[model samples]
Structure formats: C-alpha cells, structure tokens
Target: MKWSEISIHTTNEAVEPISNILHEAGASGVVIEDPEELSKEREQVFGEIYQLNPDDYPEEGVIVKAYLPVTSFLGETVDEIKEAINSLVTFNIDIGHNKVTISEVNEEEWATAWKKYYHPVKISEKFTIVPTWETYEKVSSDELIIELDPGMAFGTGTHPTTVMCIQALERTVKAGESVIDVGTGSGVLSIAAALLGAKDVRAFDLDEVAVNSAKLNIELNKVHDVVEVSQNNLLNDVKGTVDVIVANILSEIILLFVEDAFNLVKPGGYFITSGIIQPKKQEVKSALLEAGFEIFETLTMEDWVSFIAKRP
Candidate 1:
C-alpha cells in the first residue's frame, strides 16, 4: 500500500509538543530529528538534517516526518491528506507519484534483511546472544542463551557498543552479586547480567515504554525474580550500593553521572560502561579516574569503546 509522507516543520524547542499535537490529530507515528544527533559536517553533507536555528529558518525550524498509510486513512485522496496535514501544520505539500512506495515484506524476508547485520554474538564464553528468529548452530549447551528481540530501544547485541557492555558485564559480575543497569534500554545487558549469575539486578530507563518492554523481556527470559525493571533516571530513586554497575549510555551522560556511578558501586566493585564513541574514550576514562575509579581494562569495537573500572 502507498503511504503519505507528512513532513512538519517547527522549532527544535517545539518539536516534541508539535509531534504530540500531530499524534493526537491522528498521525500514526512521528520521527523527531535533533540537530545535536548530527555533526556540523554531517549536517552539511546530508541535506536530510534539518537546521533548527531561528536565524536560519526563522519560522519553520523543527522538521518531523510522519507516514500515513494511504489505503488505511485519508481516503487515498491527496486533498483529504493535505487537509489533515494542513490542520496540524502550515506546509506546502508536494504531491508526487512514488513519493511513497509499497514493498512486500514477510517475517522471513524481514529477518533476512536484518541478518546481514545481526549475527550470533558471543557476550562471553558461557553466554551468547542470538536473535529470537535466528538459529545458533555453533552455540554449546554450556553457554547461556539470551534471545534478544531488539524492537525499539537501543540494545540488540548487534551494535558494538552493546556487545562491549555485555562482555564487560560477563567478566565483572559474580554469583550472588547485586547489580544495577542505568539507562537500561531493552534490558538486554541487565537480563544478560542476571543470566550470568547476578543475584539481584535492578534496571532503570528514562522512557516508560522501555521500562514496559524491559519487563516483558525479563519475563520472556524467565528472569522475573532476578531482574527488577523500573522507570527512573540514573538511580535517582534507587538507593544503596551495588557490587557491579553497568551503564551503556552516551559519553556525556556517563560523564554527568560519573560520581554517582562511582558511589553506586561498593569498594572494589566494578563499573562497566559503553556507548562511548572513539573520540570521547579518553574523556570518559578521565571522568572515571577523577571519580576515584581505577581503570581495569578498555575494549574497542568498531567506533565504540567499553571501559571497565573498579571503585577504590
């Protein structure tokens, strides 16, 4: 079925509010692009990046992309869809054939599309992550199986940053140890830690959907008892110290919570951190060291780096 692509332009500050308004007005989903997500060079190279500076665009700054199923809604009439969009935002709607294309996709086909990038990922000698739809012919029975379905939130074991965090968790966590996963998206690393013998694992995320999804995943792995998923921001509501703390978030966030993360770990406890781009590795390392952590090991994968440190 053909789809209608609705691009809404607003201010960076107004993106979320405008997206919500559009959603309430019957838009299926809204994709918000933050200028910060792109570098200056990337913004210039890829015209896809929308600049939100008031001086640049003046009135229309933030741009949101929404796809409406033509066959499902708006009566497949350009005028109807245009009227619906105009009701939400003022825009010059460009009607073009093939502006939206329909392609046949099945479960097998969809699985294959991601398979070229997703593969059997070994988090540790005793643990491996395999996509729910993929078969792991080489995995030994001794290894723990982590069936991951990376739907929306970040962790999928496909990204180097995620895999590095998993490996660090496997090497650090011990049986009967208490663990905390900050910014626990998809609960992949937290669940993996629980499977690796962590006695009690607590995970927190900023997104409520992520919390719900993580709970579902925890149940899927039969780790409900060991893993506790909650909607929180970096242990703000979580109290007490843990034996190991795993945070697979951006370098800036890591730096922001470096002290808090350090305090969360008991003396000699481990802190495993990823989501650090190569350029920011040193910065993260310095932050951890400044927070009174002793650097243990650093692992690099692709453009990301994972660091392991110990309190005291």
Candidate 2:
C-alpha cells in the first residue's frame, strides 16, 4: 500500500500542537525529527544506544512527519492540516518555518523507521521509560520501569512535560492515595502514579485514540489493575476527590480547568501542571493562585515549565 508522508518544519515550541493537528487530520502516527535529540545526553547505565545518523534530522527547525493513506482527497487533507497548524499562532506558539513537504512511501519502510527513534530513557530518578521492543535492566533497587508502545497518541513519557509530571508524582504520590491524571495521553502519567503506590488512578483524555493507547500502555506496564483509563473532556463528570491531580497539557488548556481541578482535589491534596511554555508560566501561576492553591514548587526543563501546587 502507498502512503503519503507529510513533513512539517516547525520549532520545538510548536511540536506538540502540530503533532496533534496532524493526528486530527487522520495521521496514524508521527515521527519527530529534532536536532536536539541527536545530541541529548543519556545515562550509559540504562544501556541506551546513541548511534544517531545526522541525515534524519533538520539543522535548524524540527521536522514532524506523519503518514496518511493516499486517498482521493489527499491534497485537501494536506491543505486543511496546514490551516490547522497555522491556527496555533493565535495561541502564541512559535511555529518557525511552517514549510510542509510530501512524499510517497510504503508501510514497511515507516514501520521500522520510526521505532529506531525511541529507546529506554530515564526521565526521572525513580521512573525509566522503556519502549516495549527494547530490553532494560533495573539500575537500582528502587527504580521503576514503564514499558510503553506509545503508538500514535503521543505521550512516550520522555517529553520534558511528561518527565516533569512523573518526577512530581514521584515526590507527591503517597501509598494508597488516589490520583487523577487529566489529558492522560498514552496513560503514561496514570501508570506512573499507580507504580508510585497510588491505589486508585483515574485517567481522562478527550481523544479516543489516546484513551485506547493509554489502556494498552497501562496493561503493558502491568498497572491496569490500578489505573483506569477513560475518554472525557477535562474534568467533567469527575466525582469525589483525589489526593493528587496531574495534567501535562497545554497551558491554555490548563487554565480552563484550574478551578475545576481545585474543587476536585481534597484539602492538602496537590495539583501538578506541566506542558506549559516558559512564556505562559506567569499566566498559569496566577490562575492557580486565584483558585486558592498554595504554590509549592515550580519545575522548569529546557523552555518548558511544570508547577506543583497544594490545596490549603
């Protein structure tokens, strides 16, 4: 079968939204080619392979590639994808050179090609994300491993936003406590919560693809017995209170549910928010403060930010 590979040249700040745009436009999965990943430092103890070839990445901006079946409306679909990506400017996301290129390829080529980019990454001190196809040994007695096949729903648990969320969970999740993971793409965060000793972990995502991917990953990591994955828009229909609520979504979306998150968290519970660009840190911080959450810690990685706030 023939596939139309759509490649977009954009910046790191716009990778998440652009990837989502491609997925919404019928992309089965995406390949993110960022030059930074080529030079990223890895812990040798994890036995991570770093034999990266330079030709796969762009020199300046990041390249996001997605495959779609070459249907009759292929041109129209590509145009719509471009339009949707352009819409991110309204969110103040830097799109860089939004040049898009298309090519013809076959499924077998992409099937193994994309898998080479993912490896076992120690995202936090306690949590290490291992691709289901790779084998990793636990480096420490207390180290926790999460095996995942992210598929096309994103959330590999290696992105800075996700890394920060899991790190916060490591510090905050208590034994037998409950956790709510909003926008639980691939169920990575929810699974991490369960592994951290949370007895009850409820994960929600508006995208059905994400819900399904999360379920697969949850079971793959053997956390399905503890974490429950479902499809829902934000915090709607959520009842009772949890000890911790974690969300690694865009800051603009985080603003939408800060109040709802506060109400859903019990007193002394925590709200951990990431997927925030550095520029929007103040805006998210203000929203949490206005919602009566006492700011506990602010975590920053690269140009991204994550906040941990306690309900007093």
Best by lDDT: 2
TM-score of each: 0.65, 0.94
lDDT of 2 by residue, 1-312 (tens): 778889999999998888778777877667889898778776664435678889989999899988888999999999999999899999999999999999988889856767878888887878888888887888889999988875646646677888889989988999999999998877888989999899999999898877887888887888889998888999997899999999988889999999999999999999999999989999999999999999999998878999999999
Model 2: residues with Cα > 4 Å off, grouped in runs: 39-49
Report the CA-based lDDT of candidate 1 relative to the real structure. 0.67
lDDT of 1 by residue, 21-108 (tens): 4443444345543343343343121112333344322232445555444454455444444455444333221222212222334444
Clashing pairs in 2: none
